[model samples]
Target: MTRFSLNQWTTRHWPMPDLLAGCAAAGVDVGLWREPVAEYGLTRTAKLVQEHGLTVTSLCRAGFFQRPDALEDNRRAIEETAALGAPVLCLVSGGLPEGSRDVDGARSRVADLLAELAPYAGEHGVQLALEPLHPMYCSDRCVVSTLAQALDMAAPFSPTQVGVMVDTYHLWWDPAVWDGIARAGAEDRIALFQVADWVTPLPEGVLTGRGMLGDGCVELRRFREAVDATGYTGPIEVEIFNDELWAMPGPAALDLALSRFAQHVV
Candidate 1:
């Protein structure tokens, strides 16, 4: 369980305190989201995690560069991540601005913004982890849609200040993923590795359709092996986004994720 971290969204409904206690009892770490942390009170949440002896693997996100407040928001996120003692801050680069078709421009904006924010992250002792969402979300969710692209964006920054996130759910279809993983390791650019399977007939509002481990066509173990080969000895966070899974009680969902992670991810 040393490398298994439960991403909070996998059991979205779990109350913060219970989630911390349960993860502590299960002997696993956690990946937290900003909203939930805010709701539970960041300082209090930090104290609780410390009390329970659970590590905060990474803080889930601060990007969306297209937004006007992106800079300030991301700075705050870096501070929050530091407060939680998380080493990485996941970033989801937002898509094109309203009525904009300049894909290249949007991608450029991400690079520019990362340059400005990476230093701030470094100052706060946090690594800005750029995440490449699936291309299907290109227009509205994330402009950075490939692991290679994410890597390129991080190239200008120091590895400790900026890195790319490797998520199976987003990069599974990329034939270059294995090579990308290798390159990331060689460059010391892999900040976090997240696991979630992709399923067909993606549900409407596809954001929440991520499958539990082993439930889809993703070569779960193969991906794990490839990542391990990269010399990355970091947490493999389970970040499934399924409604059905969310409906289950928190403990039940955690149990299922743990079981599947052991069977399919390990």
Candidate 2:
């Protein structure tokens, strides 16, 4: 199978300690989230991961530059990522400010915000990885909707300081995705690769309905091969957001994810 990494959200109901232990037992690395880390106590969480000999592939996440507290929150996230020994901090740039329809302005703000945080991330020895959500989420979830846009936001910083996440779920519908991945690789801007299939008839809030691998038309292996062709030897994070998986027991969910990842994402 591919170098699989379990994204914390994929098993959102899994307690922090169990998640770490499960990953260790499965011989898999993990991608962690801030809320769970905080709930478990950041220092303690970091220590537990270390004790389990588990690698924190990436920390999820910090962006939302439209808020006044964005900078401070992101700085803290950088510190958290460093403390956890995670090499990358995933960033989901916030959408248009309340009552505002200026998409261009929101995009511009992401560039400015990245410019400010890139240096701080570098200081903390973390790469800020910009993740572009699907276009459907452009209004309320993320202003950056395409891999190309994410790459543009990351262009100002060196790959070590800032980079892009190639998430199959979000960019699968983009015709230019292959080219965008190539450009990101050529520019040395790829930081993470996330795998999730896409299904239609999106659910309410359009956030948690991601398909299990091979359950949709995402061309999973093609995406991986393209990413690997870029010489990106990073962890392939499995980030399914389906509520069905969430309701299952953590170990069962992890087993299912691992099985699908091996069958479809390799």
Candidate 3:
């Protein structure tokens, strides 16, 4: 059976210690965010995970090629992931820089930035996992918004050092998603798999409007089956970003996530 994990953003406001304790108690692996890990102190956070016998599935993100300090920041992120014993560092390539509408140029920067970081990440035994956010975020958040695009961006690098992330919430609407997953599998580029359902009437920014599993139209189990068919044996991370979920008590949210994950994903 495929294993299930929870991304920390699903309960964004949850305190780190409490969240870690909850996941340990529930025997669930967790996807961590850089901010909280930094705020809580990197060494402390790693020790906490070790003490609880918890697994850090992957670090949230470390990409924004447009930023002047992007490379340095990513180097720190790579070190952090190594400290946490996480194998993947998710990358959300930033959109076209201010006043720039050249999408192709921005994507080229993504590839170039990966070339610089891939070797460093590999040195640390971490994979740079490029995540394609929803196209709605193409303008300001992530320029890479499709599995194909992410895979292509990761193509030139070694698969062990650079790979694509498959998040159901982002790729659910694409008709070619199944084929994309197959290509990712065949290319050995699936660095991570995230689960989130789709919901309409998106909020002003559409950042936190993800639907809980089974509450929307996504064929969650089908996506899970597709990923499994690819021979991936890693954690299936639930990463809902709905406001309601973030408002619940962390434990309550976690319990609900576990139940929904069992029902709709695996």
Candidate 4:
């Protein structure tokens, strides 16, 4: 029986205290986020999680490696993740910085940064999970936009220090997606598995318009089966960024997510 968690993006309008309470009310055991915890102060946020008994699945992000000035920023991200007691810290190798069009250069910089931070993350018992964003976001979002690419980038580091996140919304269209999932699991490199549906013609490519589970065409069960085949039984985290959902109340949005997770993902 796999557990289900909700990403904070689903309830971004709610305060940290309310988010934790909402997750608890919905019977969600895990929560994921990017910089929200730090913005709210780790001590206060961690205390809230303790009071509500919620698990921090993975910090939403920690990488923007394309920037030349990213080394110190990456170090601080690792430190913050450790302080939050998050088992995994997600990374999105940023797009090319201004005045640059070299994708390979950006990737190389990401590799270098990962090499520098891997030991520190391992020492703190936090795994770095690289998330592959959709290709449409190639220019402004993550450079590693495919499961294969993310796995390749993470190959040099030990699984304890660097791993990959398999988000169905970003990867369901890849021809080699199943293979990548298998490889990640075979190598024990899948740090987290996130779920969301892919809607065509994204509005802005930055935020909003993520479909709910079973609302789009992604083969959710097939993905779950594939991941399960690889012997990866971690929680299946639901992450949706939709304007419609955001407009609704937090509890309503969470109820829909949980029901859909039960109906479509099992």
Candidate 5:
């Protein structure tokens, strides 16, 4: 059976305890998040997750190499992810810093940061999953904006040390998406498989406004077929960041998302 998980961003309006409870009530098996855990405190959040038997699928973030001062922060994020018992830590390469328009330079900085963080993450049994944001977000969100680019950066690290996060919402429109998935699997580099629909006329950059499953133009099954062909049997995590969805009760949104995921992504 395909396992279903929710991204914390989708339930940002709800408190962590309520979110976990709602996920359990909705029958979701796993969950992902960014820094909200720290706000709620790791020990308390971990206990809440345990109480509901929810799997912390992966931490939402742990990378922002654009700044010269990012190394320490990245390391701390890796340590926190390990403490959460998350098998994977998702990394967003971050945007250009002030007075820097060089995308290549940003990429280089990110590569350097990853090289420094990989060994530490490996020691903690946490895999760093570099998430390539959609090209639309290249300016303010992430410089690593494609699976091909992410794979190139990941080439030097082992799958356990570094890997790729294949988010359908980010990569669905890429012409090389399937090929990238194949290559990631061939190299054993796929660390996570995130799902969400792509709605047109995106309001802002790519952060929020993601569509619910089956609500947009993404070809979900094709993505599943590609991942399955690569021998990846991990949970298919649903990571929508829709504002409207967040306003509703967590259980209602989770139930609807799960139904859409089964009908569209399975």
Candidate 6:
């Protein structure tokens, strides 16, 4: 379980304090989101994590480039990530503007803005990890929807300043994922690795449809092996988003996730 990290969203409703205590007791790291961190107070949360001897694997986001204030917001996120001692800041490049159908323009904007933020991230000792959401999200959530696209965007910057995020839930459907993983490894552009199974009959809105490990058709171990083969020894974060899982007590949900992770991913 040394490499295991519980992404806070997997148990979204868990109170901050309890989540910290649980992760520390389990001897695993955590992947935190901006919302809960803001609500709990960043300084307090950082202190608590230190007191409990827990490490934060990564910070959940600083993108959504469509917003007018995205650049400023991402800069703040980089500072927050530095404060938490986290090494990576995940980026979810936001979708199109209000009614704009210029998909190419939106994607180009992501690259342009990233050029501005990558140096800032490097100065703060943080890596901007570009996450490619599933293509279905392209119209509404993320314009970068493939690993290749993410790598291409990261190519113009140093690997330490900009890297691509590898999330099984999002890349599972891409036939070129294996090759992309290899390319990322060769270029040293893999910043973070996250896992979540893709389940059928997706829930309404499709936001909370992520399945726990082993509950779906994803070859969890295969994905793990692919990442590991690239010499990526970083934390493997479990980032499921299921309503039923959130309904359970935090500790229970974590235990189940760990068990499933060991059985299917390890």
Point to the candidate with the largest lDDT.
6
Residue-wise C-alpha lDDT for candidate 5, range 8-31, written one tens digit per residue? 887777778888887787767665
User: What is the model-wide C-alpha lDDT for candidate 2?
Assistant: 0.93
User: After TM-score superposition, what is the CA distance of residue 227 in candidate 1 from its true location, in Å?
Assistant: 0.7
Candidate 3 residue-wise lDDT, 158-262, digit = tens? 999999999999999999999999999999999999998998889987888899999988999998889889998899999989889988999899889888988
Measured on C-alpha atoms, candidate 6 has an lDDT of 0.95
The digit string of per-residue lDDT tens for model 6 on 1-266 reads: 78999999999999999999999999989999999999999999999989998999999988999999999999999999999999999999999999999999999999999999999999999999999999989989999999999999999999999999999999999999999999999999999999999999988888999999999989989999999999999999999999999999999999999999999998
Clashes of each: 0, 0, 0, 1, 0, 0
**Cα deviation in Å at residue 20, candidate 5?**
1.3
What lDDT does the true structure give each of the candidates? 0.94, 0.93, 0.92, 0.84, 0.85, 0.95
Between candidates 2 and 3, the lDDT winner: 2
RMSD, each candidate, Å?
0.6, 0.9, 1.0, 1.5, 1.4, 0.6
| Residue pairs clashing, model 4 | 33-60
Give the worst 10-residue stretch by lDDT in candidate 5: 26-35
Candidate 4, 140-174: lDDT as tens digits: 87889999988898998899999999999989999
Better of 1 and 4 by TM-score: 1
lDDT of 2 at 254: 92
Model 3 TM-score, 2 decimals = 0.98
For model 2, how does the per-residue alpha-carbon lDDT over 1-266 read when each residue is reduced to its tens digit? 34899999999999999999999999999999999999899999999998999999999989988888998999999999999999999999988899998999999989998888889999999999999999988998899999998887787788899999899999998999999999999999989999999998899989988999999999999999999998998899999999899999999999999999889878
Q: How close is candidate 4 to the true structure, as a TM-score?
A: 0.95
User: What are the TM-scores, per candidate, against the unseen true structure?
Assistant: 0.99, 0.98, 0.98, 0.95, 0.95, 0.99
- Quote the positional error of residue 232 for candidate 6 in Å: 0.6
lDDT of 1: 0.94
